[model samples]
Target: MLTFEEKLTIIESFPELTRNDISLGRVNFHFEESVKDKKVVVYRLHPNGNGFVYAGEIENSDYVTDSKGMVNIRDFTEKELRDVIQQSIASLSESETVTETWINNEGQTLKLIETSGVWNIYAGDDLDATHATYHAAADYLYQEGFRLL
Candidate 1:
């Protein structure tokens, strides 16, 4: 389980969450201390590696969900998610690494890697779809500041 401070640190590190009044990836992250609260933080992400606003949440030590109804973190096991979140925050606060691998047109495997930043991957050969997925992943990662790796 992550403390409120840890969660807040992660949320604040995200530019999407911290800047701009009408940001697409903005999320309202807060905690109510008086009672045990389940906080929901909404953001955008591509469902099929395309572009979309996919809401998600990190709640009370045990439950995380995405807008696509995909439950990445659930029950009491969500502590691992929290840990990932913390790692992401720490990475962004300093520097982070990201790597991507995919097949190119020659039926040969290609790898596009980026360090101290984020990178996206696409499965198909459509350039437009691939570009969209890359942008979507960048936006999602910028907003959430976390990924499954």
Candidate 2:
């Protein structure tokens, strides 16, 4: 079984992850990207020399991997570690969502909906338009001085 120091050393080896951003607990090492978003990736190490990497809050297999097959986190080399972290970063970047109800000076409520990589804009009960990216949607809203709620 990997000791606490060994686990910490492996985790800190990631250049993107600052050692200060890691919280080493008795059984898990919680490492987070220093982004504005609140989501984090956790490595839950078991006492049996095995572990799993959980990407987000939801308990699913999408970004979850165990110590088996192509994914054994316990046996990952430095290159594999970089690949995993890069994968997680890419996933997190694409998962960014913009959901807010903004009110304009004219008391108009503009709804911003982001789903499946598409941005939908609605003015009241009618769908005003759709944007291909969150930036485009936000830019349209900003043109009208909408205050997010």
Best by TM-score: 2
Candidate 2, residue 38: lDDT: 35
TM-score, every prediction: 0.26, 0.34
What value does the lDDT take at residue 44 in candidate 2?
Answer: 49
Clashing pairs in 1: none
lDDT (Cα atoms) of all candidates against the true structure: 0.33, 0.54
lDDT of 1 by residue, 68-94 (tens): 532432221233433434322322333
lDDT of 2 by residue, 10-101 (tens): 66654444433323432443335434263344344544445544434322234344432124466655444444544444344435354888
C-alpha-based local distance difference test score of model 1: 0.33
Error of 1 at 37 (Å): 24
